[model samples]
Target: EEHPDNPGARLFLGLTLAQVGDLDGASREYKESARLAPDDPFPHYFHGQALHTLDRLDMAIREYREAVKLAPQDVRMRLNLGSAYYEQGIFESAIAQYREALKLNPGDAYIHYNLGLALADQGRFEPAIAAYKESARLNPTDPLVRYALGVVQETKGRVNEAIGEFEAAAQLAPTMAAAHAKLGWLYYNKNQVPQALEHFEKASRHDPDDAQTLHGLGLAKLASGKKDEGILSLKQAYQKEEREDKKRLIRSVLVKVGALSH
Candidate 1:
């Protein structure tokens, strides 16, 4: 307590508080440290982490940016900044930070995963696929990476490749509903009604509130030409669809089937 504003002591205290989930106290320590040592990035980096823990994304982003500016070669600082931007939904900024970090640590699986996420956030499916594939290759046992790769494949219209990645993700993470749903959608597109139905059902069972899988199930039922069952499934899908794209797809299908007025 001799010098509460001492940057080193404050940094350690802030870190301890952050580790124990006392974000408010951590922020206070970080602020005092930064005030005393504005030129140093340690306080700013710690402040950013504390702010992130408190869900103050905008402030967190600002602090991380300060750390990156002060410590340009510190790969961890850039990575932290990128993660903060991602939380703020600033995809371009996130990608820039991640790319900068990649230049410092090109072989890092975590960095590649971050790059993939940034690309995916901007809907850059092709680059996302490449980044995610690299992440998966670097960390083959990482279920999350496999799941991310599956998503990139799906987004890129590589349905068969997506299926393979999804299957790998499912094998690695049986509980991930998105992978199951993606596989279900791919099977539906391929006209494999039974397999599509099975994956959809699995997806629904894993995450009951997932409207996409339920909607896909409806389409699969229709693909099988069972009018009554298909109509019921479609009705459920229509009732629960929240995404604009899903709703549009449902509308187009309904119009073609004379179920909804175009």
Candidate 2:
């Protein structure tokens, strides 16, 4: 308490406040620490973390840039800076930092996955697919990596490859609603109604209120000659649908089935 100018004491207090969820107090202490010890990167790094937690991403980026400048070899600092840039939708900057981090630790699957995400955000599907494939190779059992790969593959119009990845993801993580839903849609596209119905049912069971899954289930049931069940599923989907376009499609189907008037 006596040495108010002690940067170490301020830094320690900042850490304590941050741990207790007092982000505002933590920011204040961290700022004082940085001011008192301008050459120390720790205070700037911790300050960046607090700003990031508060969603002040631009300020977080500035502090992180300062910290990275002071310690260019610090992998975690580069990773956090990349993450801050990603949050701000500065995909190029995010990619640069992630690439820099990769040079420091090339085998990190999570870093590869994050790089894929940044690349994907910029609509660089081919490179994103490459990054995701590398992530999958590094983390063979990670359902999330498989799922992300499938999404990018689907975007690239590689339906069969996407189906393979989504199927693997669903098998690896049976309760993942999106994986099952994606498999169901892919099956539906292939006119494999039975297969679509199976996955759609699982998807709906996992996330009962998911309108897209319910709609797919309804369509699959209709194609398989289960008109009554299809109608019920369509009604459920309509009730939960939030998008006007989807609601309109549900209404049109209802009208065609004589469940609703023209």
Per-candidate TM vs. native? 0.79, 0.98
lDDT of 2 by residue, 1-262 (tens): 6659999999999999999999999999999999999988999999999999999999999999999998999999999999999999999999999999999999999999999999999999999989999999999999999999999899989999999999999999999999999999999999999999999999999999999999999999999999999999999999999999999999899899988898
Model 1 lDDT per residue over 111-163, tens place: 99989988988999889888988888888888888888877777777888878
Candidate 1: clashing pairs of residues: none
> Over 4 Å off in model 1, which ranges?
16-22, 219-262
lDDT of all the models against the reference?
0.85, 0.95
Residue 113 in model 1: lDDT: 94
Q: After superposition, how far is residue 188 of candidate 2 from its true place, in Å?
A: 0.4
TM-score for candidate 1, please give it. 0.79
Q: How many backbone clashes does candidate 1 have?
A: 0
